[model samples]
Target: MSVLEIRDLHASVQVSEDELKPILHGVDLTIRSGETHAIMGPNGSGKSTTAYAIAGHPKYKITSGSVTLDGEDVLSMSVDARARAGLFLAMQYPVEVPGVSVANFLRTAKTAIDGEAPKLRTWVKELRTSMEKLGMDPAFAERNVNEGFSGGEKKRHEIVQLELLKPKMAILDETDSGLDIDALREVSQGINRVKDAGSTGLVVITHYTRILRYVQPDFVHVFVAGRIVEEGGKELAEDLEASGYERFVNKVGA
Candidate 1:
């Protein structure tokens, strides 16, 4: 069974005068348990829009089609409800919340999604362990969320949340950007750890091939003009790497 399914999904963002316009057009995708899928495209291809739409971001309107989580209707649920239903999005640009400490944010989010507070002892221990696994300093937990964090640090924080929440399906929206070699390796290791826990699915959106070397996707999809136009195994990513997305852009009529 598919853990996440997006069938003929169409979404758009509103703007003055002529609406900003549809971003995703008839995108059909299915991610099963323990599978990792990569969507690669150039700028303005709607990869990030697909992630935000699935997570119920208010900016993206579901103009048509449907999204389901384990056969449950996701479009009918609120954003918070979507998170609670085992859907997680590690954003391309993680926003900073100045007043909230990382530890507090994780705890509150976990409690809200889990419908109960996590056991204090186990939660802290596991959180610390996960932090160490990501090569983050223990003191990071005390800092304000994403405040003063470098790009790599913010990306690592997203991985920290992924570890703590252990969502059934994680949509990583360009989590690879802005990382140095070492940091990318750490972040990729964190993702691998999450996959090792079992029954988890990953949808990783990236423009570069560096991160793919570590995480290794089961499928590669090419998005252009707000629609997926090509898909294949991992080699598709290598092909894009060798030849670039120009071929895909032409093929998709973008």
Candidate 2:
């Protein structure tokens, strides 16, 4: 059964009347437990918007349709409620919280999501382990969140949160962007580690094929003009890598 379902979701960013508007139009997607789906799209496509909408960001209004988590109405939930319901989004550009320590931020997040306080000793141990798994220094937990972090460090930190929280469904929005080859491998390994723990579903939104090579998506989708135009198995990603999305673009009439 699908853990996450988006049915004909329509969303738009409210902008000036004269500006180009409406990001997602009738987008549909389903992700099940122990499955990984990759969404690839050209520039101006609504890949990130889809992820944000699933996470229930207030900025993007859902014009129509529904998003459900394990049959629960996700669209009706507040952002915090959605997080507590086991939905996570690792953003492309993570913002810095200068005053907040990584340990404090993660602990609070875990406490909120789990509806209880996590034991400090146990939580710190788990956080350190997750940090090590992502090739990050143990001392990183003591520093401010995302403050002065390099691009690779920011992505790795996001993975660290993913590991610590162990959300049932994780939406990785451009998690592979701006990382060097080693960092990319580390990030993919972290994702695989979580998947191996069972009952974890993934929706990876990306523009390039490099990360897919490591993560190995079960289903690959092509998003164009705010809609999923094509979907197939792993081979489709390889095909897109070789053919450069031209075929898919023509197929979508874009």
Candidate 3:
């Protein structure tokens, strides 16, 4: 089984030319294949930073501690190397790629990760099938990636990659942001498709619990002040929905 282990992961985000703002402070967590973990926290509590750090985002620097995937050092790998090594991060705000079509983008990504291109006939069929399952029109295959697409469309495209690439570990950074209920449910179903495969580890980072109801997590971690303050099962997420992060914030302050 695949394993992702984070130990005392301390990191800082580059704020300016010369300043780095400390974000993650001695964070520790672990995810095994087939397990879904939710990282919940208040705004600015370093939830996104953790995802970026694990994905080797250059903007987020790892000052100390270690992140490893199946005994290999993750922090040392380059961004592309991280992806080829089976780590995927769906950004909070996906950028628009003006020239690249969705079909070309997904095919190139799949080829890069697999170290070879897929058969043209089979890839096309699979691409259309994935989009249909996500409620996306097959014609979107010709549209530029996230260019002029709605917020829901961009998020759905991210999941399309998640399905095609089949990464060993996926960190969804705020997949539910800006999505209406209908869009959210569609995206969650796409995610559940991967979860059902039981091969990829899932780390869902968000401030809200709505998505958790659809993509129910096996472990719920309450993050505060750059570290996890409490952890429990799915019930903890329900409690957070009812009570919110105030108690966790106070516990951190205490």
| Residue runs of model 2 more than 4 Å from their true location after superposition | 17-20
lDDT tens digits, residue span 58-101, model 1: 88899899888988999999999999999999999999999999
* Ten residues in sequence with the least summed lDDT for candidate 2: 12-21
Q: What is the C-alpha RMSD of each candidate to the true structure, in Å?
A: 1.4, 1.6, 0.8
lDDT of 3 by residue, 1-254 (tens): 89999999999999998999999999999999999999999999999999988887789999999999999999889999999999999989999999999999999999999999999999999999999988899999999999998999999999999999999999999999999998899999999999999999999998889999899999999999999999999999999999999998998899
Q: How far is 23's C-alpha from truth in model 3 (Å)?
A: 0.8
* Candidate with more favorable, higher TM-score: 2 or 3: 3
Error of 2 at 12 (Å): 0.7
Order the candidates by lDDT, highest first: 3, 1, 2
What is the lDDT of every predicted structure here? 0.92, 0.90, 0.94
RMSD of candidate 2 to true structure, Å? 1.6
Q: How many steric overlaps does candidate 3 have? A: 0
Error of 3 at 8 (Å): 0.4
Evaluated at residue 174, the lDDT of candidate 1 is 97
TM-score of structure candidate 2: 0.96
